[model samples]
Target: MGCAISGLAAKAEFGERNTGDDAAAPAAAAYLREDQIQMIKESWKVIRDDIAKVGIIMFVRLFETHPECKDVFFLFRDVEDLERLRSSRELRAHGLRVMSFIEKSVARLDQLERLDALALELGKSHYHYNAPPKYYSVRT
Candidate 1:
């Protein structure tokens, strides 16, 4: 009940929308600042190859932050040993594959179609995992 969002669409109440505030609405832009883009590109280069490791750490941290999250993964659902789960080959494969797709998404951010396809694939996987949209946000 405390700000739990569970859907794909974000819902925020900032008073009424469609209240003839057209002039106050900001324009959306496709172009990112060159410096920011370059910084992201350069930063990503350092960690791109070790995305699997990154993914592993990220999951570990997520579970650490909220142990309940481990329940979402059937393989790790009943894992009694955190270390064992960390070294799990199945977990490694899944984490690596997911990370690869994320890396691909970043690399292809300029391609809207590719991003959309990746999102669609994620949505399907989420359905199977029973992961709420808020779970993907990692802020729940």
Candidate 2:
């Protein structure tokens, strides 16, 4: 899915124009309410936690199901191995970085400008893995 900001901007820029009172409102107007912002922040906390938990669980399960991936983990052979590849110090730093991003994103979920960038980076990092796309579909 697209980031919230980029998705909104793209829609405002290229989508068909509204033809009524809605047309007079700014494209971002829908996102400016304090309540909406709060909601987004709350939602983001849930989203961030859910995604992180799901990611970790999935990684562990993948390795359990296919022990060959253990070597990949030690070698940073793919995105799934990032957690294992870093040194203790590097892992600490990376953890902090990830937490900071998640906190910031949760604080300002309505302004989701970096999500797409994050997704792209993840996709690139995972590209070297030869597993079929369907491999991700098999749940533990």
Q: Pick the candidate with the highest TM-score.
A: 1
lDDT of 1 by residue, 1-140 (tens): 11122111212222223424433332111123445446766788887878777878777777788888788888887887778878888778878887787677666656656765776687787778677555653321
Which residue runs of candidate 2 sit more than 4 Å off their true CA positions?
2-72, 75-87, 128-140
Q: Show the lowest summed lDDT stretch of 10 residues, model 1.
A: 1-10
Model 1 global lDDT (CA atoms, 0 to 1): 0.61
Q: What clash pairs does model 2 have? A: none
Steric clash pairs (candidate 1): none
For 1-140, candidate 2 gives per-residue lDDT tens digits of: 32343333434554535444543433332334566667767776675655545445544555557766555444333535444533334434444555556566455445445643554464566567553453343110
What TM-score against the true fold does each predicted structure earn? 0.67, 0.32
Predicted structure 2: lDDT:
0.48
Which portions of model 1 miss their true places by more than 4 Å? 1-31, 133-140
